[model samples]
Target: MNCKFLAIAVAVILFCRPGHAQTGATVLDDFKPSSLNQPGQEYPQVNSQGYVRFRIEAPKAQSVVVSLGLGGTRGGTPLTKGTDSIWTGTTAGPMEEGFHYYHVTIDGGVFNDPGALNFYG
Candidate 1:
């Protein structure tokens, strides 16, 4: 029993050590508009690393959030409003490759992204 307890304690310590988490690789700046975007839209871009970036123009909105992150387990990716009155944000991490359904929340009301082509289901 003592041996088992000692092993468990060591494992916990190793896992909790600082800098033992994800790598510190920087997110590249190379991003392009998603192919699913509307014909002249420029936002909702995807980077090579599979990170998704969103930009929404809602000058009067109090808050804006994107419903695309961690498979929707987390509420969503909250955007920060810039001085230009445009809200923007990036996913916390790289997302799995493939099509993903997402929507925007402006001032608490959910709405589809005007820049992105609508996809049912």
Candidate 2:
């Protein structure tokens, strides 16, 4: 019993260890829905600094990716799947100001943000 208790304590400490933290970066709290957002939709938003954040719902998807800033670093940002069936992530850096096109790829399939309006250009 004592041995088991000691093992449990060690495991707890290891599990609770802090992860590498971010430094010297501040994301402003001034995010707003993009002008391309459909009425009443607000998942894909952009901050004043041009950082784009995306939220996609795909509970069973094995992977999710956005085409924003493609061919750039990390081949675009990948969304982390959450327990609530939603995948979310932010751009690695601020995007260029002006119109940019992006789409979501889930589990090898491509789809558009339901909250965003589509354009043909």
Q: Which stretches of candidate 1 lie over 4 Å from their true place?
A: 1-24, 71-74
- Report lDDT per candidate: 0.86, 0.81
Best by TM-score: 1
RMSD of each: 7.5, 15.3
State candidate 1's TM-score.
Answer: 0.77
Question: Clash number for every model?
Answer: 0, 0
Error of 2 at 68 (Å): 0.1
Candidate 1 per-residue lDDT, tens place, 1-119, comes to 99999999999986566642234657799999999899999999999988889999999999898989742565898899999998999887787688988889898899999999997
Full-model lDDT, candidate 2: 0.81
